[model samples]
Target: MKIVQISDTHLTAHGGRTQENFERVVDHVNNHLRPDLVVHSGDIVIIHPDDAADRAHARTLMAEFTAPVLVVPGNHDIGEPGAAPWAGIGVTDERVAAFESVWGTGHWRHDAGGWTVLGLNSELFGSGLGREAEQWAWIENTVADLPATARVIVFLHKPIWQVADEPTDHNLDIGESRARLLDLLGTVSLAAVGSGHLHCYRQTRRGETLEVWAPATAFVAGDGDTFAGPLHQLGIVEYDCADGTVRAGYRSVPGLDDVSATGVPEVIAAITALTDSPVG
Candidate 1:
């Protein structure tokens, strides 16, 4: 199957430069790429996880795509997860429920073409909530029982690692659950893992798995990078999976302006108003 992976659209009904760029992404996917499926690696809305209008606008914008879309929840969609989540916007059950009410299940599995594709809710990784435990249990049981010959691919909002010792909260490594999740995945016939949160694009090879970071369809983090890392321009990732192998590539579409979160004044103002933290 041909799949296009888009991430971090950061939609907001209020003042949405992100949504304007995202509509270009939608147009590109519809008229040019024309993939069989489009998987969004999350951050579907900008800050303010409680904003229903943002989520509704996101849903409406995504409807422009020609193919079916699947999504995983990013920190912006369901709040951050650690004990010291950014600006104290930690993930909660109510926030998760609200995310699901619009985006459907943030965790899901689809089987096709000899491959098992899994979408995980990254906001639940270390949230210490009942739903987090439930997701872990499901992952354990499901991952353990995967067909020995089936090629597996996992998609989530947060990555498992980063470049060398450069640490960033943009990944699951910030949580204590990384080792366990990796160990479980290590046992499977993993083919590739895809993620997006850093608002950047990168790739790494771990044993037999290809880890790809799909860049944001929204703005690059730039000066607003609460969690710092490489800042790449906006784009998407494409994957071709067939038989038991997958090929991945980064595609930078046309007409996407390169700017930081400052490009959207409303997003910056929301962060300051809600979290009492200025754009760092």
Candidate 2:
């Protein structure tokens, strides 16, 4: 089975280069590399979590893909939640509800080709919100209910790795959440844990589980990021799941630009936009 993973679209309502880029991705996935499934890891919107127009736009754009698409809420789609939430906006039940109103659910599970593919809301961890525990329980139950010998694949938005010794807002994993999640998945036939938010493509192995960071479909950073991959390339990840294992290959669209995130005006505006986002 082949799966295409796209992430960090950061699209606006009216339309911008980001939307154009995502559309290119959709066309590429449909025309060139037809995959069994498409998973948009997160960051479907520009910034505001409660931006109904952006959410609606994302839904419409995502529906263009021929294969079934499963989405996990990104910090941009729903507000961020951690020691240092982005723009002081944190994930809340209402923000989560807003995301679900368009995307149906913040998480989902699909049993496909001997693999149990699962999506989770990463922002919910350490959120201290009402739905945090609920998502945790759902995750535990979902994994527990899977077949004893079933291989599992997990996807979420923010990465759960401790990449730096000085964990800032960029590298924050919210304390023991990573260990807690890994421990729960330790019970399953874990194959790969896919994520985005880093805006670059990278794959690494932890013990036996593969960690894939899908490249941002939108743009790279011109001014550099506090904790970002050195490669400023933009693309997607194609995962080939067979032989009881998975191999990930980075794929870029034919004409997709390796533009900078700061060069995009829409993205900068989004970073400074205010909202009644039902978050901190």
Candidate 3:
């Protein structure tokens, strides 16, 4: 199965060149590599920006997808500190609700190409742990009931562990929210674990699981120092259900004067190359 993952397109009414770059990325995805599914890992807006309008715009963009587009909320998509109506309620709930209203609960389970795919909301304080616990229970029960040979894939908004300069948010601390799921998934012959939030990309292996983090489709966070490089990137990952393996490729759009100082298309290309491996 071919899946494209994009994240952190912080769009806003304050038009900028970055927005155009985002559109370019979108157009590229739709025109060339037609993915079976597109997974957006959040930060769809700049900051609330008239919630109604912002959300409408977000939905419209997502609707352009030729395949199913799955989304999860990001810290920016909700609101940052002192950011207005959204801030009043806490970013977690408001942002999550906004996403759910347009895209349905950012979490669920389904069958994809004979493989089980599970989406979990790891953005913290949104659905609350109790709700998460319930989802966890459901996932555990569901997986346990499935045959031992089932191939499973997991998706989330935040990387379970930090890579490079991206700090592990309190919510996604591998010791916390991700731990339960990881433990339950330990023996599941996981095809891959995909996530975003870290604008920088990285991939690793843990036993039989392949954890892949997709880069941002928007701008890259300035990492204070040692962060000088073009940042715009989008990932296309292909998974082989028959053997539980994933390979991904990426491309960088130019003319992004708003951000991305270095071209990162090679990053995407490199990740996509992993598909040749026997991950399952």
Flag regions of model 2 displaced more than 4 Å. Answer: 171-175, 226-230, 275-280
Measured by TM-score, the strongest candidate is 2
Query: What range of 10 consecutive residues in model 3 has the weakest lDDT sum?
Result: 80-89
User: Using lDDT as the measure, what is the rank order of every candidate, best first?
Assistant: 2, 1, 3
lDDT scores of the candidates, listed in order: 0.83, 0.84, 0.60
What is candidate 2's lDDT per residue for 109-192, written digit by digit as tens?
Answer: 999889889998888888888788888899889878988979999999977776567646553343568899988999999999
Q: Kindly state the number of residue pairs that clash in model 3.
A: 11
TM-score of structure candidate 2: 0.93
lDDT of 3 by residue, 71-131 (tens): 7766555532222322343444555566678778767776776677777666552345354
Candidate 1 lDDT, 161-246, residue by residue in tens: 54336555544443567788889888889899999987888777888999998889888867645344444789999999987788
| Stretches of candidate 1 exceeding 4 Å from the true structure | 162-174, 223-231, 275-280
